[model samples]
Structures are given as structure tokens and as C-alpha cells.
Target: MSGTGGRTLLTVRGLAKRFGGLVAVDDVDFDLDDGEILGIIGPNGAGKTTTFNLIAGALRADAGSIRLRDAEIAGLPAHKVAARGILRTFQHNRPFKGMNVLENLLVGAHRRVRARPWAAALGLPSARREDAALAAAARETLAFVGLGDHAASDVSKLSFGQGRLLECARALMGEPAIILFDEPAAGLTSVEAERLGGVIRGIAARGIAVLLIEHDMRFLLPLAHRVVVLDRGAKIADGTPAAISREPAVIEAYLGRHAGAAA
Candidate 1:
């Protein structure tokens, strides 16, 4: 279903993946709309990360169709998929160790750089102008993710939660049509998770599609416009947060019997 007034931006059908004899993902299908936050939730080994990897081109799908609008992106390499405007953040922060926060963010904008290597090597006017512009945009993204003050700080100086926000800002610098988040709230404290939730909402408000795979139900349910539940690598429920909370199968499989009351 479309979110608010947004149109469909991503479509997945019969998506399947296997690791030897184990089925990691089994014929999953879903649609993501522009400006929507779609959460994929499941217990351990339920194919959440595998599905995420397939969509982001981090892993090849053994069978299925993954389309960004009308173009097939299922088998594309990671860089090619990123070039097509899909960016992602990992469960663990992976910032550039030697770079300052802003410099790290600038790396994410590499796809948008227009100057030729020769021009940049020679420090030509065009290259200088492009560098300045990208740097400015990177700063804006840093501020947007609440890391404005850390722009000049060493990446190692930031706390774990701050590092996660940095990962988010770096992805935003790519100006992605869709952003895949793998367990974003995994290592965050309650307050940190809440803050991150607000940042995610802000991202969706800008018309970027958000596909999140999170194990934290409390964080996922309230923030997602729609939730897709998986059990044993198969989708068992798909609906609004409220509806998902009350699903018998979902409750039994993952959410537990108290899910309705908790939600």
C-alpha cells in the first residue's frame, strides 16, 4: 500500500535465497512506496538480513524479481545498485578511521562528483567548485542527523550512538531513492533509539523510501507506517503496526502473546 500520497517506488516478487541446503528467504513479495517507512521484522534466522542483502545488492538472489520502479536490480553488483540510488547502513558503524566526520560524509557523495580525475588532480577551478559544493551539502546532512558539532571531530572520538548517526548521515549524502537499514536500533539505548526514530521519520518526510530490518519491536512498530513479519524465512503477516500487533500468527511466531498489550 502507498503511504500518504506517495506512489510505489520498489517492488519485490517471489524473492528467494539459499545457503547450501538452507532456505534463507522463501518467495517473499512486498511493495515499498515513496516517502514510506516499511519495517521488516522477524526472530533469529528468519531471513530478515538475507532479504535486506538481496534488495541492497549485497547478495545475489537465487530467484525473484527486485525492481526499482520498472528496472530490475536483483542481480546488480553493490556499487551498481548504489549508483542506481539505493544506499544502505550496516548494523555496525563503519566510518572511515582516518577521516573527520565531515570528510567521511564527503566520501558518500562520490557518486555525485562531476569533475574528472585529471581536473581534481590538477586542482582546477571546476574540481574546486564541485568539492566545495559537496562539502557544503555534507555539512547540511551532518546537521540534519544531529551531528553538526562533530563535523571537525575525529570519527573515533564519537560514541557508539553517535557513530550510528554518522552512518546515517553518510548514507543520506548519497541522495538515495531508497535506503536499506539493517538493525539500526540494535546497539542503541532507549533514548538513543528514540532519537534515531525521529531522524528516520525526517528522512521519510523528504520522500526517500526506507526499508528497515529491525529486531526491536518497540522501536519498529511505532515508527513504521507498515510492518512485514517473517517466520522461518516466509512472510506470515503484512499490515499496519496496529494490525500486526494483533495478528495471531505473528504473535505466536515472534511478538509473543503480550504483543497487543505492549504495542
Candidate 2:
């Protein structure tokens, strides 16, 4: 198996979803190659978020299969899915306001999916060791995402761009093989977005796959290795950025989809 049949790190086959009489997502199939930066785009209400929700286990799929590195993961709980090396960020870069930035990141490092709660609560020696390891990893992850200076800062204190970086840092703390990013560059300034683009390339350099759902084609174009276009829950195009931008079907899909969305 090669080309479409081989080297895929993630796969969605026969993917579908339903809400009463509405089909939010309908039988979509796609593959994300290993370490690839896959950019996904669609107009408003095109089921892009629905697809992310389904793959991230935020919602149950009516029918289909989601595979990470060839392992089936459909119907699994969100945390369990994350344990299988899949981490996801939402369109809104919501950070826990109760915890400082570092503390919030440390929480994400507990990726084993099983730990002695009481031990952790009481700060047992084993738990202390785990905390230390996570704290160090969190620092490294923060620096990797260009938030090292803000490590001791509060989450409620971050700028929009900084918050997005923190979200990526938190996801990296889990040591995920792949991360699903939803509108990561949304609400960012031009300079901030460019910095984030550089950071994403660094992430790919670290050998983690990134599958992003973005509406800003101008920003996504330079970063994405491949682009996938969705229309009314179905994939309308899949190819390089140049090819995708030239596809008439894709242009039509975005015409009435999102007025302010850049192309």
C-alpha cells in the first residue's frame, strides 16, 4: 500500500454524523500522512467543527472509524483518545483561569490515563517524582512554544496570541504524536500569526503530525503541506495549497460560507 493506501498516520473512513433530520457530517474519508501538516478548510456550518468533535471524542459518531497510526479509536472517551497520542485544541483558546500557566501545563503532562488519585492528592513521593518530571517537561514545552518567559505567569493574563501558544504548549506536554488544532491563528495579530506559523513548522520538525482546521487560507497556505476542503460535510478537494486554491469547487464552497474568512 502506497500513495493513498500507505504512509498514513491518521485515517477517517465512512465517517458520518446525524442530528435528528440533519446530517452534520456525512460519510467523509481522509488520511493524514505521518508528520504531515494537513490544513482543513470549509465555510460556516460546513461540519468542520463536527468533524473535529467526532475525531477528538467530544461527540459520538453515528457511524465510522477514526484511526491514529492505524489503531481504531472511534467511540472512545475523550481522555482515552488523548492517551492514544491524540491531543486537540478548540477554536476558542480557553485556558484554565484558576491555575497559573505552568500549573495548567503540568496537569496536561499526566498522560498515563491512570494514577493513584489519593497519592496525587496527598503528594506522595511517587506523585512528587511525577510532578517534578512533568514540571520540567512543561518548562521545555513552554520554551518550545515561545512562552518560556511567561511560565510563572497567570493564564488569565495572557494575550490572545500568547494564550494560543499556551494551548499548544499544554498539548505538547502530553507528548502527543498528533495534535488537532482548531483555528489556532484566530484572533491573532499579523506578527503573532507569523510567529505561530514558525512555531508550527518547528512542531513538525519535532516529528509530530498536525491536523489543523482553519478558515484563513492566507495563513494556512504557507504552513500546510496539504489542504483538504470540506463542503456541506463532504470533502470537496484534497491536494497542495496551489491546487486547492485553484479548484473551482473549493472557491464555490467558500463563496457563501464565511464572508470575512480570508482566502
- The alpha-carbon lDDT assigned to residue 38 of candidate 1 equals 96
Candidate 1 lDDT, tens digit per residue, 194-241? 989999999999999999988788898899999999888899999999
| Model 2 misplaced regions, further than 4 Å | 1-6, 112-127, 255-263
Among these predicted structures, which one has the highest lDDT?
Answer: 1
- lDDT (Cα, tens digit) per residue for candidate 2, span 173-252: 77888899988888899999998998888887787888888877778988998888888888898888888888888877
Q: Rate the local accuracy (lDDT) of all candidates.
A: 0.90, 0.83
Clashes of each: 0, 0
For residue 82, give model 2's deviation from the true position in Å. 1.3
TM-score of each: 0.95, 0.88
Q: What is the Å distance of residue 128 in model 2 from its true position?
A: 3.4
Using TM-score as the measure, which candidate wins? 1
